[model samples]
Target: MTLSYRVLIALLTPLIFIYLWVRGARAPEYRKRWSERLALQTVPVQARDGIVIHCVSVGETVAARGLIEDILRSYPQLPVTLTAMTPTAAELAQKLFADRVYHYYLPIDTRGAMARFIEKFAPRCVLILETELWPNLLAEAKRHGAQVMLVNARLSAKSLRSYQRFSWLLGPIWSALDLVICQHVDSERRFQQLGVARERTVVRGNLKFDCQVPAATTRAAKQWRTELARPILVAASTHQGEDAIILDAFARLIQAVPELLLIIVPRHPERFREVTSAAQQRFSTLTRSSGQTVSASDQVLIGDTMGELLFWYAAADIAFVGGSLIPRGGHNPLEPIATKTPIISGRHVFNFQPLFDRLTDVNGVRLVDDAEQLAEQCLQLLQQPVQGQTMAAVASEEFAAEHGATARVLADIQGLFPPPNGQARTLKMILTSNPNAATEIWFDDNLATAVSDDYFAPSFWRQKGQIIGSATGRASAWFIQHQPQNMLLRHYYRGGLVGKFNRDRFAREAIVKSRAMAEFSLLLQLRELGLPVPQPIAARYQRAPIWGYRADILVAVIADSQDVFKLLLQRSLTAAEWQSVGATIRQLHQAGVYHSDLNCHNIMLDQAGKVWLVDFDKCGFRTEGEWQQANLQRLLRSLLKEQGKAEQSQQLFHWQQTTDWPHLLQGYEQA
Candidate 1:
């Protein structure tokens, strides 16, 4: 799925570039900030744990306002990064949120870009408003342990038909979503058909209906309206073809009401100048961008500003939402409801059909087909203020009825992380394979990728220190410093006759329970049993042909520690130091943890006089007492092996000349 999608996106990038170039010519905003679109901004995306909310444009951004506030109030300590896809929406997000969040332009939905985006943000959960379902974005987000959700989600029938054509591609993507909060039952059913589990799909009311009109914007609207004559009519978010219909209707309405003023606000910034140029040719026009004082003689005003949609809705007595006038579905209808402004739209509001139905039922929205019908409705609404006021009030009431969803949304999000022992909860992940690759992994869910043999590569760590290589050809290890502590990364290998032919591969029997995993488990058990040991960070293995395998494990390096073998050659061991070694071994045997290859090199003592055991490859738990004596015999043989090879010195306790074994035995037997 990723490869297929990548190829399509790659092939279409040139066309996409051309589209952006054409739009950039009209709207410099699109071209001026290329770094933001590519996620190359200087500011860091995010860090620590928090939620990220993605809103596609101004309409969806407004709908997410209440939900964002809810999340902030609930989890005050967590960081928030709000992202937008377009410049207008990004600007509006800053105005609405101010310093409340870290804001950015959402990156292009390619795997590399998405991976970098996810890595930078490191978000614990991601909330996407409405239906911005980018497959690679979701997949990469899940790979990094983000719980993705679609809020105020709706799947239009048109979208459903299109998505069905790529069911195989989309099904897995839909299944990866942690939650789908839909606006209606129809959308919920549609999502279920597209492979969303029923348990994860929820029916939540439209958040747009729950939005409130800003008091500051309303006050500004009143101040702006004082300069204009009575009976102001606004054609808000007018699309290209719809502007012609609106201008025609306004031309007729002006003759019937001489005091009326028409306002045309194009939906996009690029069209502002185009609409302004076209409107100025026939009408006495005033534009917000020109900073001209309004006059009763001025027939039309072009709304060429930003972050003032609600202000325009509040400034007028009636509004015709634009896209409906043409076949372009429709813009959000609920924008005017918050301001108690009457709405007039065309019959083709398929994008907001369900919302239009509810408004029509309450007699709050009037629908018209052509310019003449639109003029007629505007004339009547202006003539009968009482009827128009009643409709506006109902629209605001309809908005209030959907008010409680924010709290409900907050509740469900809170349920995702319950406060337990005053710790931030981590996601639970079971052992699972990467479907895109050929490997398996087990770890805490937050990591971006499964820990595997290749994970030990120096590139994986942020800083790989010096790699110390041993003279022996049996095995290899690297030293690196990651967060929290330094780590030792070692690849497992066999020695002696078996190693000559097999090299790096371990026996096939250990495939199910690989040598690395066995050692990792043994270390965990030893630590749990109160034995001193290095922390086992992660372990993994890759299979070879014939089921043979190579394995690796990363363990925290103990600070200020040296092996007993090195310490022995430095000075003659005191009786207390020898006794401490015995007690350490006694503790391991008493806890039923057996070290299969314990020797002088495997035991270490820190500067503060703490003893630790290391290297548990091919080691595990045992119930019998027979292995205890055998382990001691093995250690005795290892000591003699080292003694025969080393040159004797009076400063060291040579195994041939000392009673060190009797002292060790004395401490072991007494304990």
Candidate 2:
């Protein structure tokens, strides 16, 4: 007891002091941003032929415990695991089941852990208790073939009201659940209002009833009743501001029942000191169940320990649940009912609503609107033991009748096993920056794949498939269907801007028309003469525009050739190779197709070193003067951009004039 209280004090002392200090201190401006500290390490676990259950906290775990145990017993051959997000819940689960069930801390819901965990635990079925629906978890689970179900579900009215605020993000996630077993009709209705389809949801009653009430729990209550000299009124699960309300009510009640003793239990154990301090300040005489005594003038008594709540209920004449008076969802009233104790709760009984409604329907519980009414109700109940006993008896009967929901849920799940025959083909489409830099294929059920960061650069792939390359940003190349298919995917800004200067205002419409005109005109002229050029199979210029409206161009692959630049840059060219290369260029220019901004990288070479003009988006008519000079200048600029020396480039220009250029002009003028 000392160690627990000390631990509580150690945990809460700083929080209380910090709260007080901050309240009095000048505060900094509030910023609307997520702090980096909030990130969680989410890990995914793979469960092959195993049942994976997620229960958030103590209450959900307790309710789901029976169902988990039943599955283990029924399917002895199958493996099962449980995951919890909180330390206390994990500790409780560990203590409850020990080594009987596999227990692990649930990783934060993040892309990395989620993918890895799914790969680790290829669960056959995933049972999520209550309303702990996380978006990434749900989506990943569905992607990995795990059938998901929410069992023993209950959505409070307050929670439902809050869900309405985020319905857009919440709706699709809720819809993803394959099945939801609600604890009450009201809970089912609330879920439906939040967009949970009725077809997927069914009411299975609260599983808490299915749990066997401990014998010693009842005996301890009897012992408490025998030990208390005065009539005891229990204020259970009270919040911070609520203890004062309970004290105000108790002050009034003590006037009527002079021997009245107030037993106050806080909702969170960490608040024990704050509650006890308040109690000490209010009462002249107070006593704790741990044997600390106070004078009769004292009005408040703190029941701060856990695993003693049942004993407190047994010792009390009437129980008032907290949070209801303060607008927070009322704490569980079932605890008091399970011990055959009469209950008086405030109007905000949203938490244990279904149980409260059942109790009210059977005259098993009393509801008070405020502190005054609570005091009056407690006075009346304490004065008349017969009335309290009758109500307590009714509550016990209702608790017993509501049992078996766990068994029903388990039985239904049993029939859902052995999934339909036949497996479908796995086809995955991943949206990533670059396909070349990827380490491994993202073909896992969880879609756990990564792309390389290097593919995000701009200038590296603008030129390809030609001996003379064009540095027209408007025409770029990429791998399509994972092959080197030159495409004008994103022309200028969108694709059709003619100059780098006009990139800011590039239009998709102009790009499409220009690309089609250039490619088609070249194709028609080349095919007429029966010269070598890639046959244009199909073309699309007015489809799928980018930032601007420019559309991308795609073409089919041509076979049996090496790009001329790759062939020529490596070795000495033969006479036949030189003839074919020079002849192709002459035929193209004579055919009135002069490639604007042509550099060596733009031409393709067959095994025989035959050259072909490609990347027609920058090709222009072979007219005299500045248009021809501009094309030559653009070609020189591209060569310089590749770090070619001014002297070698001058030699390439000299070759263009004396050899290839004159030959091309002779061939063209003669033709």
The model with the greatest lDDT is 1
Worst 10 residues of 1 by lDDT: 421-430
Q: Which segments of candidate 2 are over 4 A away from where they belong?
A: 1-50, 68-105, 116-124, 154-176, 184-200, 208-212, 227-230, 252-260, 284-301, 350-362, 369-372, 397-401, 417-671
What are the per-model C-alpha RMSD values against the true structure?
12.9, 20.6
Q: Give the 10-residue window scoring lowest on summed lDDT in candidate 2.
A: 28-37
**Residue 132, candidate 2: alpha-carbon lDDT:** 88
TM-score of each candidate structure, all chains considered together: 0.64, 0.49
Q: lDDT per residue, candidate 2, 1-671, as tens digits?
A: 12343344346544644553463332211111112112232222112336778898767776776687787777654457788754446656776677666666555454444655555555668888888876656767777667888888888888888888765543367767888889889999998887778888888887877755467767776776566557888898788778878878878887888778888887765567777877777665454646865345556678755445667776777888788887787877777777778988887887666667888899998888777988989988888899999999988887787778988888667666642222211111112121332111111222122323222223434233332232343454543222343322223343344554554333443321345434543453354456565544323233233433322333334444655445534543454555555566656655556676466566667654456666675564554445544554564455345434535565332233344444433433454
Computed on alpha carbons, the lDDT of every model, listed in order, comes to: 0.76, 0.61
